[model samples]
Target: MLKYMLMIVFSTFLLCGCSYSEEKISTFEGQIDYVSGKQIKVDCSNTVAANSEESGDQVGVGYICFAAINGQTKLEDNNGNSLSINDFTIEDKIKIFLESPKNIGKSLESRKFTASKVILIKASPAPK
Candidate 1:
């Protein structure tokens, strides 16, 4: 009787341990630095608060991070047009929603983020 009880308890614990939970998502704004097959490097140097009164200077020394894109990832432009990874170009500003890295408190370059969505922010017209 004791052997059967131990087995039942062990099975219950094993099943509980195998359950999965979704990872939390985080967002960051930056410019596209590089793009490859299914990955991109972002230069998050110019991120700033929308309502701040600052002179548009970068908050601090920004670090570049790479994000992986998957089929489930959503991509869109400011005009609500759907886009693909191939539409991105270097120097294009974007806002990215991604899974926060496990070691977030560590140095900037040590973290890894996986992108879930990307929104393109239109660039301003250049002076002639």
Candidate 2:
């Protein structure tokens, strides 16, 4: 009887321990369309697919997303080097880890996608 009770307690503890992990953040990848201060607009048209499209090519509409960077957000470059927003430029490819959208405004142009982290995958080419 004591052995069975111990097994039940151990199983409970294992289940509880496995459930206490960091919340998962959603990720989006695209090229930078615009950047101002801590805010960035990503042109995800080539990357994101609309829900209506089952073939993944029926829709021709562009999909752009905006993300806001705060002090807590982590920024890193392709080489795993630490970076800042200043290091980013238009046309740069980035992967954004976003916090769930809260009160996303009606207008897509005005909607804000809060980012928890931003990783730079490729830098834009320098103009000759």
Q: Pick the candidate with the highest lDDT.
A: 2
Whole-model lDDT, candidate 2?
A: 0.72
lDDT of 2 by residue, 1-128 (tens): 99999999999999986763322327767889998887989875543433222335644246677898888888898777888889999999999887763432224743467888889998999999
For model 1, name the residue pairs that clash.
none
lDDT per residue for candidate 1 within 1-128, as digits (tens), equals 99999999999999988864333337767888898878888875433222223344454345576778888888899887899888888878888887553332224544366788888896434445
Residue 39 in model 2: lDDT: 92
Q: Model 2: what TM-score?
A: 0.65
Each model's lDDT comes to 0.68, 0.72
> Which residues of candidate 2, in runs, are more than 4 Å off?
1-25, 46-50, 53-60, 101-111
State how far residue 101 of model 2 sits from its true place (Å): 7.3
